[model samples]
Target: MTQKRDLENKDGPSAKKVNLEFKKEEIEGFFNDKIWDNKFQEEIKEQVEKSQPYRWGTITELMNDELLRNVRQEVLNEIAFKKKETDIYKVHQSGDLANLSGLDWDDLSRLPSLYKLRAGIYSEEFRDMISRITGSGKLSGVKTDMSINTYTKGCHLLTHDDVIGSRRVSFILYLPDPDKKWKPHYGGALRLFPAIVPNVPKTDYEVKLVPQFNQIAFFTVQPGLSFHDVEEVRADKHRLSIQGWFHIPQEGEPGYIPGEQEATEARSTLQQLQNKELQEYDFPKPIRNDIPADELKLYRGLGQECAFSPEEYSYLRKYLNAQYLEPKNLQRLADVFMEESLVELGGILNDELAGKLMDSIRDLEINTKAPAHSSEIHFPWKCAMPPHKQRFMYIDGKESLEASEEGIKFINRTGPQELPNFQLTGKAATNTVEELFCQICSFFKSIAFRKWLLFLTRLIPTSDQILLRRFRPGSDFILATSTDSKLARDNTDEINALLEATFNFTPTATNSKNWESGEFGGYELCMSSNASDDEDEEDDPAIYRESDPNDDSVLYTSQCKWNSLCLMLRDPSILKFVKYVSVNAKGSRWDISCQWNVESSDKDDEDEDAATS
Candidate 1:
């Protein structure tokens, strides 16, 4: 109320205008004089043209400091922000600032400074200046767009190129604590990533800009190339900013073209779904190599037996809960899985192994430092590539390799081997986490475990790939994606599906106070792909749908838990993702994930048929 009272007298009569319009002559009055300087404008143009990774530029003291400060105050006091989280981002965002012009007098009166700020930003003078600096051509004054966002501790926007419909420029005007310097350690920097090709972003960011109050960062929206992400906020402070985009001129505006917007949309990142060539650039592709002949034969033979052997029981007892080994319990599990196609088992590991794992993970979280940077991640661990889709640390039981243009192409063309082996880590595998994870991976891949899985699911695995993964707090996640279409092609004998299993070893207590309610993220979610309808198939598969509670689209929600295992039969139509871990999480979401191409079992189907009769 005091800020509003102060603003009422600051601009007097002009502030009450129903349709606020910025005059060309008043440019210097609304923005910093430095931006209007011709020499400064040319320097900015040059800097943007030569910017590394991609074309981008920044302006410090971009707006009239006093006016912008007043606007920030108005935004903080008058605007109501709602927290929204999806697979791609998490932030508290105010409703679109573009609607400020439509507000009634009573509502408008509450945010005069914010209204003035929006008008000044979309003013013809400022738009021209931005256009010239970024060489993004003409920008429309009519199609104004903006929203205010506050990135408090744990909030983030993951890697994305600002390419949708007719967007020419993207900018963020920072409004943090004006008097204090925004530190790099606070972890709210705007990071830019290089692309291996057009659509594939590199595993690591190549550049970052730590923003301060009144500093505006802007870039030309290059399809697939201009990739960037907002690093997660780690400090208990608001990193507030007004984010907006300048679109190509609309009809009746200067430089408007009849079909330019359509042309731009045609080239958007979403179009990659229809382009098979671009799909090759994606990393950790759903390339599940065919199972080795001998291995397949062994599993098929074991599937005929109803129970485990003495040798098999001894091998499994080293890792599995004793109760799960009981024939009656195993039969019950198989029956449940056959009916529902999925099951979640808690206390999955034996007491000794589980205790050792929990202790090692808790120690890693409390004492040893986690790798916050890609370069710091060493042996037995590798960072997943192409940050636009996923970011996490994993051991795929192979030699660690950097993602290069040649490497991406090589893997795409030749295809990698079917099974993973942890022997590549050698001496480096001695660390408790690595050692335990390797044993787990090996256990999942072992013939003994395959036999157990066969009796439990009545499906024979034809191929397998196992990974020991750590989704670190604030820095890792896999965006929602469906199983690869290739899974269906792996086997011609019967209807094939991916028999997937995740053994969670996250040390966080699963109570509501910690991770159970999903506030701190680190949840693995599975949903119906919704790809059945012909109309829905055209929708971008990567976009997260806000499912209605009554809808059956959400198949399962697995919160971060300690010593639990989730088993599911995944067809190509099931979508899944691990939610981005918040900085507030107790530790990383630790798990060994296993995937196998499984042939449907006629035996289980007949048993169900008989029971129903």
Candidate 2:
């Protein structure tokens, strides 16, 4: 284990000289002399200008080596870090550095190197240099923003463009072990993603930078173009770094433009809606296809009668537990579901099928290596796109991979032809994990199971989609988001909520404690939604309120488990997310997720009784 150290009590040699004031001449001494070289400056500017995906650049030996080393030492010794986990990120972080200017004498003396480092970073001369290289216009030194983070194994940040508020430039200075070189496989690379248009980030990162000690990476805060993430730290080593942003020029600063910040905020609000065309760019779009008339007629005819035919029972018995199929048990479960609009069944699958599934999944997990890159993932399994919203590998019953715009259009188009037919695929299943999951998908979509579902929930299925998802460790997650407005709209005559179910099949040894601790993520969480109607200042849809674990807003949290199913009726006000699977997880989070547009089974009966009267 790594030994812990506290902040040094002794002041450094420059501690007495350093104060809250910034001097132009002093800046040159703080940074490497190469930074002031005309040739180096021009080359860096050119690099930023020609960079792909977005304008960005990196500088090696960014600061005075000794000074930065001391800064790193002081940070590790003095600052206490709190573990922060949210929909988009998970890491240990120190408090905001914006208050460094007001620190009392004792505190200031203790963090002299840190204070000096901060001053050097936000000095007028340094900000001007950054402004020129990135061509992002003048930045305000007064509004200094910075935070120190130590991303040990399992820490990660999901894809997002840094477009919040008045941020003009986003930069990170690496402070990992100065003596050793950081390697690519260590997994703390800064990955940059290219966008399909402006707001939609591609499914995978095209470029990544593995930072070394004293290296700094910075980019202009383009609203949609500057999409990036910190790849999960796969190695058991501390990856220390300082993250900060240079803000737009403030009222008293040079190059200050009145109302510029407000205009940017307004534009950001417009971008959030993404317009209708942009919505098309999102993969596995929220648009649920309407059910066919024949299925609708069948479901309506079965109203109030939860009875299953012998043939239907036989078919369902192959997948579901025998007890679940018994009429008394079904009615008892239905009573519970009806009262709460939710139910979780343990050992949901029959012993024969469940044992086989657990074995196959375990074999696949232990014997076969999971794909590390998006490109390495093969068909039947496609990577989810527009990764800022979600990042996971899924089998959505599509025969061919469809990631292009034309492909999205074809899949999302109105028609029963585009609807998934997992049964057809299950016919060819070879008992592999993929085939077995496909079979599970088919079971959920089966008409016989729909009748069993009607008994369990008293809801008539209108339309459905079933997905087999694999949340791989260190790579996949779904951020907090609510049901699509179109599907969740409150209509007295129509469905107000969607019936959802998740069949968890994460294989784990009985004694393993990783999944239960919630330390390795891969949990499904649902919270009361805080989405607002105000366009100009909508709440951040991705982050939970500072992500307090004890907050009552979290309605449910289901850990990765084996042979369990969770059923719930989700309205528009509910937010859900699959936490990012940590690299330390025992295995991938395997599950079959099913969704349906459903109406109350009693609705048709009431209509018929009124007509008869």
- What would the TM-scores of all predictions be? 0.89, 0.90
For candidate 1, write residues 240-294 as lDDT tens digits. 9999899899999899999998898898766653467867766455555566789
Tens digit of lDDT per residue, candidate 2, span 405-480? Answer: 6666676684245667776766655457777788888788778888889888988888787888889988888887
The TM-score obtained by model 1 is 0.89
Q: Residue 77 error for model 1, in Å?
A: 2.2
Question: What local lDDT does model 2 show for residue 362?
Answer: 84
- Indicate which candidate wins on lDDT: 2
- Which ranges in model 1 have alpha carbons more than 4 Å from their true place? 1-17, 273-275, 292-305, 365-367, 410-419, 423-428, 510-512, 531-552, 603-613
User: CA lDDT, every prediction?
Assistant: 0.80, 0.81
Error of 1 at 196 (Å): 1.9
Q: Stretches of candidate 2 above 4 Å error? A: 1-19, 269-275, 303-305, 405-417, 427-431, 486-492, 509-512, 531-546, 604-613
Query: Where does candidate 1 have its weakest 10-residue lDDT segment?
Result: 3-12
